[model samples]
Target chain A: MNKGLLIVLSGPSGVGKGTVCSVLRSKMPNLTYSVSATTRPPRQGEVDGVNYFFKTREQFQEMIARDALLEHAEYVDNYYGTPRDFVDRTLASGKDIILEIEVQGALKVKEKFPQGVFIFLMPPSLDELKQRITGRGTEEQHVIDHRMSVAAEEISLIRYYDYAVVNDEIDAACKRIESIIIAEHCRKDRFMSELADMLPASEKV
Target chain B: MNKGLLIVLSGPSGVGKGTVCSVLRSKMPNLTYSVSATTRPPRQGEVDGVNYFFKTREQFQEMIARDALLEHAEYVDNYYGTPRDFVDRTLASGKDIILEIEVQGALKVKEKFPQGVFIFLMPPSLDELKQRITGRGTEEQHVIDHRMSVAAEEISLIRYYDYAVVNDEIDAACKRIESIIIAEHCRKDRFMSELADMLPASEKV
Candidate 1:
């Protein structure tokens, strides 16, 4: 079986990455979503390995020491990270996995897995990003302003990505990402064996 | 408007490259099929600049001297090559162009345009290739054998390509090629200015 691809998706806040991912999951049922490991306690109805690989701080630190995480960060006195083993096993089993991370973490993951297809999601415009943040209606004006500024910074990092998908319409964005995944599968590097098989068996290519 | 991609499609003999190109043209009306310049006299009904850019031996040699052809070779006392001017103008006008060439010529074009998406069309299997070649009913056994050996040699050069698409079914192969073109547009290299635009004007990214 062919090995699966590791897709790293990152975007500025309020760029609709989550919504696009949800639609993508519905479209492709076999796609594996990376569940992060965190030291924070799970809320109600969350399950271990399903919601996250909930770990103790000591355990999380041990994992960090062992270099078992693709990327990790400390937020609110708790540790959260992507475990490397699950990703490796899923890909080896021919199941594509997506990692939805922040820009810094995504860049860090790229340093470790340069083969991963890094994609940056973009809002239709800066105005749209502000509207989406305002549409949430939960954050204060100051918080919204802060988010817009941070989003601008994140957009600057898009050059580091392999592709930038504009999420103007949910279906169209999903289709573009889907096409990217299919195209990556057709990459020449992935078909070396198939090419070799086409050679004469006696030639010993 | 976004600049168009230069797509180079190559395959071994009897791999259905011509058939796929025909179907692809119908599906993608905006795509431009590159016209080649040749020193050979045109056959009856072949139109200049439509079928091929018919030129005299002196004219073709002059074009070569001026570095006007993307790639050229003398075949059976007739010069055949892809003209660079038409391709450049079409791409500059935001129209994607497809060049259907042999393996050696495809590699030669790669040297001139490294950004071009090089795709290798492949038969589902060697058995399928033989069946297709024999189905033509025009070539003799020795000719078919020679074609198969040449195909094996061409397949060995697939590593030089950017992508390999299996032509199991014409429609599916065309769809894969279409997806590849769409995905290439999303490449970061092609969207640098768009990425810069996504930043806030005050940010000076």
Candidate 2:
């Protein structure tokens, strides 16, 4: 049996990664979503292990020290990370797992798991990306300008990805990502060894 | 615009490559079929350039000497080969072409166009393969055994292929091949350069 694919989806902030991920999860019920460990209080209806693996600052630091986390980062006052064990277990059981993360964290994960499929999501255009960021109106003009520059930086790192999907529409983006996962499974590298099993030893030349 | 894909489908004899390819062509109206140049005399109703580029023995030999043929081989008393110019023109015009050929010819084409998508069709099992060969009933028992051994040899070459799909059912096999093609277009190598075109110079970093 083949191990499941570890699909990591990343892009610049506000590129609709969250919306796409949610829709993908709903569509592929069999796909497992990697739960993240966070040092933040769970909001209402957010179960400790379900929404986030609630951990104290000490516990989170311990995980980082032991290298139990695949990738971790501090945002505001909280530390968030991907646990390595869950990913390993789900894949070994032949179930695919997906992680929707920011670009920096995605690169860090790639360093650890080079075999994982990396997908970089992009907005229809940078102009649209700017509008998406601006529509929120939460950030000041200078801050928005800073984000645009950072978005360009993330796009520059597109070389490291296995597929770049334009998030022109949420449903269309989800469909493309799903196709990438199915296609990755059919990749020659994955099936080369499997083919050996199909041919009996006595018949091989 | 993206260039058309060079889809080469090959497999052991009696693996139903022909049936699957015909079905695929009907479904994909835009796909172009590669026409071969042959030294054999054209039969009734066979049109020049449509059915084949029928050539005299000397003309076929000249095509081989001039390196105009992509791959050529002699069978019985006739020679057949693919034309390189037609393939280049079709791809340059942004249209996909499919070549349904034997395993040996497929390997030769792969040497010249390593980037082309190579799909190796297979039977459900060797036992099934033997049955498919035996059912032909056109050959003697000794010939059937020879073909079975040859099929085994070809199955061992799956490592060179981009995908191996079992022809358990014609429709199922076609669907898998179609999925492979769709997935291939999304490959990072193909899209990496296209993404650069999407961003204007000023937006690039």
For each prediction, how big is the interface RMSD?
2.1, 2.6
RMSD for each of the candidates: 2.5, 2.2
Over A1-205, each residue of candidate 1 has an lDDT whose tens digit, in order, gives 7899999989988898888999999997888999999999999999999989999999999999999999999999999999999999999999999988888999999989999999999888999999999998999999999999998888888878999898999999988888898899899899887666667875323
Q: Against the hidden true structure, what lDDT does model 2 obtain? A: 0.88
List the lowest-lDDT window of 10 residues for candidate 1 chain B: B196-205
Whole-model Cα lDDT of every candidate shown, in order: 0.92, 0.88
C-alpha lDDT (0 to 100) for residue B166 of candidate 2: 76
Instruction: Report fnat in order of the candidates.
Output: 0.70, 0.52
For every model in order, what is the number of clashing pairs? 0, 0
Q: What DockQ do you compute for every candidate structure?
A: 0.57, 0.52
Residue A62, candidate 1: C-alpha displacement in angstroms: 3.4
Least accurate stretch of 10 residues (summed lDDT) in model 2 chain A? A196-205
lDDT, model 1 = 0.92
Residues B86-145 of candidate 2: C-alpha lDDT, one tens digit per residue: 899999998988888999999999999999999899888888988888888788999998
